[model samples]
Target: MTLPSYFLDNPYNVEGTEVVGNKLSPENELIEYFVQFRNDDLLDTLNTFEFNLEINENLILQKTLMENKDSFRNILRDAITMGTILLNFDRDDMVNINLQGKRLRNNIKINLEVPSNITLKELTASDYEGDVVTFEAKVSYWSKKRTITHMADYKCPDCGDIITRPFKSKIKDRCVEDKVFYEFFKPNISEDTRRITLREISDDFSEGKLPVSISADVYGKTVWEIELSDKVIVTGVFRSIPLRMENGKISQEFIPTIQVISVQNMKTDKMELPDMELMKKFQDLEAEGKLVEAVIDGFAYNIYKKRNEKKAILCSLIGSIWIGQVGKGNPPMIHILFVGDPDTFKSTIMKYVINVSDNCVLADSTTVSNAGIKAIAIKSDDGRWSIRAGLLPEYHGGVVFLDEFGDLKSDIYADLKAPMIDGWVSKHVAGEDFNGRAETGILASMNPTDGVYDDSKSILENLSVLKKPLITRFDLITKFSIDFNNAYDTQIGEHFDKCDFEGKPESFLKDEEIKLFINYVKTIT
Candidate 1:
């Protein structure tokens, strides 16, 4: 077959004899050709063009490589084999081919930025099978990265000829002998690898039901840059590997994993200015000095008294926006522990916060374990490392409410210290290290050791069962007491009566006003 006249144009002006020769392959002409597709300058920086690959838009690539899929397939294989050559990056660094396009149309279009890309829930097995894709997801499990040699020298026993083979290839005789014999020599190359499992996470800052897991293998700088439970947008090629069962039997099913090429951390927060009108209203409220009071009243109307405690919860609701650079700024997250006797309505307060805040993560203390704090890394029966995410990591950048906090094991309470201070948990398991960051505020309620507050004794005396270090971590430690003489305290009795019904009691602040207040508070620097 004769090649098209356009193939000989050589827009890149690269020196080569053949149209698809080793001296100058079409892979080398890809960037240059795309640049000229829009009449872009050859000398300009590559960043000038935006190449976002939306997983939903697969035809963009299929359309581009339609004529010569095999040739580019070989290019992609070579790119992975010698990753450093054409891209001018390390062998471990991934090379992404970003293809952006419109939805529901045969014709594709490229945009500088693709707004509102498809979520992980929208992706099917066929969408990602053998092509490069991009999507936003949360990190559920992070495996400890290990350095292994890729290229190794081996001497064939038959011919005594030194030959090179990748780490996967078994020693064999290609030099004339029917029987294979080889001697191991030193390795020549090393690679950094960390495999991470990503799940379709709800971006609403609430802990929702996670979909099935997708495997993503991050290399080089990305291995260190990505963290567990982080919301990230990643671009990579979908690769399928043979599935091995627990008994080491290779199954017919193939597991899909992404060879990550680029990754970007997506900002996640509960409160968002839905529109400019809401933003204007928030600005007006801020100017009037009613925004703060409105926010406090929004959630506190359900709870009876304890104005100070309500204010503390409000502060926790709108955590500090500033992250310290020079030194640790005031711990942005406010952890509140309510120690009270039975019938103090401590659990009621917790329930109120859970209902009011959209970003609240509620869990019973009975259900929490040491592994529930961050991530649990366990060696599977198959001798492979497996990780499970805990409540704290899953609810990062949100509120964590533990009702019946006193019932938690001693070790569990001890585990809260790291998350309280540093806002993250670091654990090393199965010969791998993992750091899970949960920048979350905590609200917990528990009964005192003696089941009642002793005013005659010191504050520490009443809470002797709990450790001092754990007690000190709480920003506000309030004791809820009932004035026993007044059995029909209108406030407390009315609260219980109101809560018994289906509907919530009417609040002075309207729901829209509260939402506006939340939107306003989130805008604070």
Candidate 2:
């Protein structure tokens, strides 16, 4: 059965209250629960039902509904209907009916807020089957929002009576025309339903685990407002779809899906800025016109050579952000490509900036793909298409460090043109149009071919792998060479010796102070 929405439902089970035995049906049980617990929310604009596993442990414990999520959600829907009907019992038709022809209960959405669910550790331990669980994940993809009819406003063709039947009970495709995407898609989702793709955070992938990705058929205004890369807590009932065979027929194989109950963005994960004292300290630096110099000093202090390269990167760091995008004269963020020989400390240099900078993602060519850097179209077992954002949109307002940039795939190199030149990119993939705004800075590093930097060759010749058009997008190119001059080598040797001799090399700022200063500058800049 294809169910993408819990659309306009019939008012049911409002015979005062069901006075059955202790083993109350799920719908009656929820009504009793709402009356006793969530009564205030029932009358509120957003009809949210907050269910805490820790608090409402007893709600489904005796009834055994928690084990079967489909049945649980089905009953919850019915409960919402019965509760809405209960409100009409006291509502005066003349007074409650507003100019918009909407009752107070017209937009009463049943948002089920589950505070706890399966975790990464728990997922490895046992199979969840089809349990209704909650978990936090990053939104990777979204189908463009389309309007869908919640309830039929037109009359039945056979009988001129106003058709107020439950959307499901009505003959499929007779009144409500829903396009089939394996699962049905009504798509009139302006107020109600939307489809989004959620993937487990990158931490799971770093553990050499296949990060889980699932399609969520979400119902509500809240989840639809979430943008790409927004970390969200989603509550949904798991289900399996029959996998399609190569011959375009349904096979015995099954793939999992989630019918989302409700979703909320995980707001607490945002970076917490430092206290007033540190913030004010940077403000004072700006006031004294020494903020830029102070930020440069806070950068890599122990690295011996590449003084000019350091300044170039500092230009990228400050200039990339401070350079406004508002005015016509304003330029996009500065992009820098560092090509050098081995032991030139390119990795060390980029890592320092990556560590100091907020929202920095390191994508090495050895691992990432073209689609991984930009957006890609993903198709689920059911024939639905969604566009998943790549590294650029994930760290949209921030910078990305592309390591081992020379070894990057040729196709991926060609893909970098649109983004580096223009601040936006569009991919017309799988019959879906995906456009993303990436006001992001690029600071990429590469070791020259054969582990040696050739100063005699032109800038483009030294880096033969990257295309000319793509290379031109970079605002600055810094080349690092290993100078074997006796004086320079002795100085480098002395710096290394000092590191081994003393506990550590001297720095202009402490580790904690450096982080505070960088983040502080990022904000004001």
Candidate 3:
């Protein structure tokens, strides 16, 4: 196949006729220079272009290659396009190349300053006009694919001229000589699409703020690789789509949309401890039979004196942390419910767990629904079903603190019974089925109906909302009450008087140390 004139540094215009004294574009110049001066290098580059990486000091590609980065990039891009032409690879534009070609490539990545990964808060509306950027986010929801024009091939009957025009580009559409309508127009389109909603996530939950999400359109080769809840690092151009008015007029408002260029699945396949030195320390503690105590000291550093509750939470945390290790059949998922009186540290303990948890979700029972706690497929305005997985399935391997568990709706109890009893959530909505392993542990809490525990009432009677069958799902049931004990009251009084509540005590273990240990346990698991 003959290469297009524009594909080389030829002075041939759109008319396929040679033009004299026209200034060559950077790509044209680079291509001509490469083929003439560095034919071997150019050919080698074309062959191994897919494996190219960041212009680093390697034995083959020298440091001088990065000198004229823009020019070199132009050459590489030209070579890649030529390779595409040779291999009959599908590509839309420079922004959207065959991602399979960029598997381990570094040259294209150098175009954008990555780790330029800004949070949704920092990525302002005004920043849409900027260059390519990177965002590390979780794929929250993915919509169905739709076809779009990649390019159009047109030919003129009279002049016998043909020209290829990319979609949304100002390239030669009709024959340059005829300047007439095409004799034949064949629009090349692709249905390779993965439209996803990316939500801003932080382990701290950003102190309980509304999550900022952006709708991203993944195309080309990376579409099929992405899945729901997959943590991905995306590098793309931020293109704002004009919102249409109800009256069909284009509104002034624009939608936040990203035309994804590359999607690097950053999901951790295995938990790994960062500190090797700390592993030895943990081993020493374990050998001395003080590991559990150390973990408790670290985990309950902020608390005054709630040993039983702390140990219970710790046990559940350990179980949730290592739950992924279990193979075959169902895992022994640990669920805990802390029923307590009002004006106690129930919420405090939940908050502490939230702070410590890496993949934990804190749900106020008043605001939660079956949709929010589990996966449910809902039909959108377009009549297409889209799966919206709740916090439980979304944070599958993690734990969820269902605060104010007493206030949980009665219907939610029946819905959760199956998932709790058998570690799985099956939701079939309007012919849409979503069955996933619900391995998430629920660290839930409840307060008494009268704001004080009554000795006259049974556990189920105190919280009328909590049914017996649903309550049985929990392996541990701990009670938080102000018992009128002399020694307990003295300890509480002493803690209230002496504890500064300023900085963490020197004797207390740090959260990182505990996290490292847990991660270490996961490595072994």
Candidate 4:
């Protein structure tokens, strides 16, 4: 067949191709020539096409796109034409095609219609430009059918306005009440799901407090309820639209509702008095010459009763004044002096008292000076200045157990005179001034001069060995005598032995009772 003039005029044809005599008509000849040429070209192209373009398949396309840009463009154009034709023609069928020797470097949009039988798991997108770009997409598929209904009712406590709306899940449900309009979207509910009503109480509107009760149910079975105060507000849904509150004038965003938890006020009862039996037992122990042991045993009980009775004080005297009372007319600072020979249980008792007391200070002559009790100023990391109780301040309402009292320098002893009597310590350390009253007792134990008590020596003479002012500071002074005479020694030893052998030994009262007593004294003081 002869080629048509139009075929030769086609731009895709060579730039200067002449037309021969037309064997067919103008229109029919153009169609026939184009078909023949296209058939021939396609046959020749298919025959020569190399399925294996490069030995390295991965490098073939990348190399072609970079080295021969025109070829890459031609391949891309052909791919797009092919894709459009396939999409428009076989719109319901799935077709796969691969573009060879081509590179993609821009965004591409695609619309997919999910099959009714297929469920969508996830959706994602990738950018060929390697730049951050956000793309939004959604999945559409047929889902199991169900019904959902939303019934909303709200009351304005202040305005006395009531609004109610009924919405059905199958179609559009709109309601207008109290001069306000609402559009509700019904959610798909499964067979196992049920509808619930929630009420939210908030303090956002009225200043008055509201009493709210909250309850929950599953499948018509009640689960729990809580009583909440008006200060709290609840606003989230379980699988449907949750209860919400609006200020009658404006339509606010929906908020989930919450249940309030109620609390009960607890009343503390007064402690009851000890029975007569307990008191009689303590009295019997005291009468049997076990006063110290009895006191230790009943110390906690006594202090508790005494405290409830509002007694004056509870004091514990160990190596030094290990405990005292705090009240009006009580001294702010109490200086306790321990002046005795080594291994006299003075230091042991002082350590015990210090451990049991809430606060205590153990200082010797070196740590303390004539200046006064050293009060260290401590500033917390949070920028708060805390007057940390030093040995004296720490033991302010407790005891300051002083060991080696006689060993203290004369000047230091003299400095303690005023604090011991007046209960005040004036400290001037690092140019910082601290003056406070410490209401504590001074229970001091002193050894007689020469390490033994001399009966012939007068009380004034014995105390003269110490500073005059220091000696006069003590309220009661007693000397512990170690009698060398066998009669007196045996009598005491046999008595203690009988007590240990016949009754509960004094040593048995060493655990919780003694600890409770020490703690009780410190706490009350």
Which candidate ranks first by TM-score, i.e. highest?
A: 3
Give per-residue CA lDDT, model 2, range 1-525, as digits (tens). 111113223232334444446555566667677666655555442334333223244555325356445656546655554454454344334233221124322344444556756752344213765767788887878775555454433344543333333334244434443332122233222245667777776521212244667767765444446788887787776766576775887787766667776676677336557788877876787798876556555566667756677667765655444254442334556788888888888867876765565556666765456336678777755667767787776767667778888877776776677777666767776576667777677888888776687878877788777778898888888877788899998998787676567743333444466666645545666
lDDT of 3 at 425: 75
Cα TM-score of candidate 4 = 0.34
**What are the per-model C-alpha RMSD values against the true structure?**
8.7, 7.1, 7.0, 34.0
* Model 2 per-residue lDDT at 313: 70
Task: Give the per-residue lDDT of model 3 (tens digit) for 1-525.
Answer: 223433443544442223336754444443344445555543455345432333232322222233333234334455444443333333333323334333313232222123445666567668655345677888776666655664556678778776655545345456668777564456643336656778776544423444767878776445656666777777666777775565888777777777765567675656656576777777788898887788887675656767777877766666643244444344656788888787678777866776555767777764466335566564543345667766666777777788777777776677777776556777774355666666777888878777778879988777666677887888887778877789877877666555555556655568877666666665554
**Candidate 2, superposed: residue stretches over 4 Å from native:** 1-15, 19-68, 71-125, 142-195, 203-212, 238-240, 244-252, 268-270, 277-328, 352-354, 366-373, 381-384, 409-414, 448-451, 464-469, 486-513
Write down the TM-score for model 1. 0.66
In model 1, residue pairs whose N, Cα or C atoms come closer than 3 Å (at least 3 residues apart or on different chains), thus clashing, are: none
State the lDDT of candidate 4 residue by residue for 1-525, as single tens digits: 122111122222232222346332232322233234334432233233311122123433344344433233233223332323222333323222122111111111111111121111111112111111111111000111223333334444344454444333222322333333333332221111121222222111112232132221111011111111101111111111223345654333322211111111111112122346644644576688764544443333211122211111124332223244533254444333444444444344444444333334455444444213434443322222423223343234455555456656665566566666655567653234656555455545556667765678776675556866677776545444444588865675675566566664453343334444444333344
Report lDDT (CA) for all predictions: 0.59, 0.61, 0.61, 0.35
lDDT of 1 at 355: 47
lDDT of 4 at 455: 72
lDDT of 1 by residue, 286-310 (tens): 6999655655665646666666777
lDDT assessment of candidate 3: 0.61
TM-score preference between candidates 2 and 4, better one: 2
